[model samples]
Target: MSLTWAPALERPDLLAEPVRHALEAMASDGADVAAVEVTEIDPDHADTAVLVEATGWDLRDMANCIVISGARAGEERVCAALVLGHTRADVNKAVRKRLDVRKCSFMPMDEAVGRSGMEYGGITPVGVPSGWPVLVDARVVQREHIVIGSGLRRSKLRLPGALAARLPGAEVVEDLALEPPT
Candidate 1:
């Protein structure tokens, strides 16, 4: 019997109401997109290290999503950056250049939460507003599956790395990530 395994994942519906573009685009396109698996978590355990330790999932298979803004007078330019667990976005060089701004900085937590409609730790790339650049490190796009935010701190999402590369405004940039310091 040919069985469908990917759909067995729980909570795909949780993303239903507002319909995040990232996930929606993948599902709608129906080509080269992997099924997504979502898991609920305690709000306090939403951070990387905590979630890793609690679930014992391989650290390398996880990616983080960060929201950043460019400094352009009278214009709102925001980008959602996706990098691996042990890596960080190269905000000063790569990101600034990509966003074509003089400076780029992490969006303030409160502002991020408000604009994303996602909790502080749960902001994923799925539902980012249209035209906002979703910068994804090339390294992340090769993974078979990676855990990312689910627009709510109470859950985390797992899907194909290729799927993330296809999200709206997703730009697969080389060297978008920098190794954490020693």
Candidate 2:
């Protein structure tokens, strides 16, 4: 379906380099996905809350990609956790248990941006480090298509939710996020 929200990923200018590269790689392997850049926003204000309000997008159609790390002695093991914007990742319970670690927390902003090679507030699951799991909430894939960060604050990705489920080292976990109180 042609999307009125954003244009095709055929033009590299429409997406961040990393995101375009990731999408190109996916397309080369025959995965279908698309992305678009949103004009008139300060990159520093690209967090989910800001983007959602700025673009007038439905919260349920969007998900936040957060880099989280587990406690380890020598080296930290980090994973990209994707959860619906309306809910929060279950870091203390679900994530810690899933990672099999005593404690887990959101990666420091500097480290997350540095290691992921993506801008802060614009981290996406497409090009995460190899072997790092992309834990996607089950609710995410149930949607036909969803919006995600583009590894750059200027743009966003619209793609089949199942594509996230198929990303490298992806783990589709139930209740990865805890819903907010009604």
TM-score of every model versus the real structure: 0.86, 0.87
Instruction: Candidate 1: give the clashing pairs.
Output: none
lDDT of 2 by residue, 27-50 (tens): 788765543323324575578787
Give the per-residue lDDT of model 1 (tens digit) for 18-110: 334555555667744446766667778889888888878777788998999986776878899999998989999999998888988999999
Give me the candidate number with maximum TM-score. Answer: 2
Question: What lDDT does each candidate get?
Answer: 0.78, 0.78
lDDT of model 1 at position 55: 78
TM-score of 1: 0.86
- Please report how far candidate 1 places residue 65 from its true position, in Å: 0.7
Off by over 4 Å in 2: 1-8, 34-45
lDDT of 2: 0.78
